[model samples]
Target: MTPDAAQAWLEKNFAPWVLALSPRVTGIGPGGAVLEIPVTDAVARVGGIVCGQALATLADTAMVLACAGELGEFVPVATTNLETRFLTAARGQAVRCEARVIRAGRALIFAEARLSSLPEDKPVAAASATFFRP
Candidate 1:
């Protein structure tokens, strides 16, 4: 899918709270997508670090877009499993996630995502997810 279509899909399909993160689809190509979320107060914890939940959400959302790009269109899919690992704290910087489809079978899709703190480009988190196409 094109970047503009991906952005519109995100805005129309995601939940309100997920959209509140202000995720922007920077790029989308075959089997992969790039998304960015600003590190605003809404996503920060008491210590000013971006929370794990928000990062995980971004990862999952990015992966979904990656799947759409892989399929060449949007289709209903459900997350069967999602694993996230926090490598470092993201403080006061926007987060960027690069997600790609690792494998796509008839019924399942495997994907992975890496998130980095923008500007500095420090690795912040990684994620892998399984999605079931029903």
Candidate 2:
């Protein structure tokens, strides 16, 4: 899907809280998607570092977009499993998530995501997820 359509899909489909993160779809193509979320106070913890929950949410959302790109359209899919590993604290910088579909089966989809701090490009988190297409 095109970037504009991806952005519109996100805005229309995601929850208000998820949309509150202000995720922007920068790129999208078959099997891959890239999204950026600003590091604002809403997503920061007491230390001003981006929280794990927000990171995970971003990863999950990016992977969903990747799945949509792979399928060439947005379809409802449930996350069967999601794993996230935090590598560093994301402070004072926007976060970018790059997600790609690892495999797409008839009833399942496997994807992985890497999140990094912008400009510095320092790794912040890595995530893998499985989605059930019903």
Candidate 3:
């Protein structure tokens, strides 16, 4: 889907709390999506580092879009499982996530994602997840 369509889908489809992340789809492909997440003080932990939970949210949400993009439509999918590894503290005000669909089938789909603080050019977290249409 186009970036504009993706943004509209995010606003209309996600729950209120998830919508508050202020995700903007920067790019999308058949099996990938790039999203920018706003990092405010509210989402940051002590020492001004963005919290892991916030990054995980970004990763999970991005994977959903990545899978839908591969399918050429936006459809409801449940995240069955997500595993995240925090690499380093991200100290920026904006972070980006790149999610790629590792494999997609009739039932379950697997994806991997990377999170990084923008302009810092270093990864802060990595995630893998499974999703299924429900």
Candidate 4:
């Protein structure tokens, strides 16, 4: 999907709380999307570190965007399941989320993402999610 289409989808489909997380759609291409979530005090848990719940929510949202991008528009999908592994703490910088669809079938889609504070290959959080597509 195009970047503008993705941005519209994010604005229309995401939950209010998720939107309140202040995730910005940085880039969108077929089968992939990049989102940046700024770390704020409200999103941080203890010691000024980004919360795991926020990371997981971002991951799930990114996956949905990826699947929608791959489909070349928005398709209503629900999160069937999501698994997240938090590897490190995200401090001051905005966390970037890169998500892509690994495989998509008629009824289900598999997607994965990495949340990182750096541009390097390392990820602070890794997530895999399954979606029930409409």
TM-score of each predicted structure versus truth? 0.97, 0.97, 0.96, 0.93
lDDT for each residue of candidate 1 in 1-134, tens digit (9 for 90 to 100)? 68999999999999999999999999999899999999999999988899999999999999999999999999878999999999989875799999999999999999999999988989999999999999
lDDT of 3 by residue, 1-134 (tens): 79899989988998888778788899987999999987788788898898888899999999999998888999899999999999999877698999999999999999999999978768999999999977
Model 2 CA RMSD to the hidden true structure, in angstroms: 0.8
lDDT of 2 by residue, 1-134 (tens): 79999999999999999999999999999999999999999999888899999999999999999999999999999999999999989876799999999999989999999999987999989999999999
lDDT of 4 by residue, 1-134 (tens): 56677877798888899999988888887888999888888898878788999999999988889988888878899899999999988776688999999999999999999999744535789999999986
Of 1 and 2, the candidate ahead on lDDT is 2
Candidate 1 segments whose C-alpha is farther than 4 A from its true place: none
Residue runs of model 4 more than 4 Å from their true location after superposition: 118-122
Candidate 1: 10-residue stretch with minimal lDDT = 87-96
TM-score preference between candidates 1 and 3, better one: 1
Residue 133 lDDT (model 4): 80
Q: Which ten residues in a row have the lowest lDDT in candidate 3?
A: 14-23
Candidate 4: C-alpha RMSD after superposition: 1.5
Q: For each candidate, what is the lDDT?
A: 0.95, 0.96, 0.90, 0.87
Error of 4 at 59 (Å): 0.3
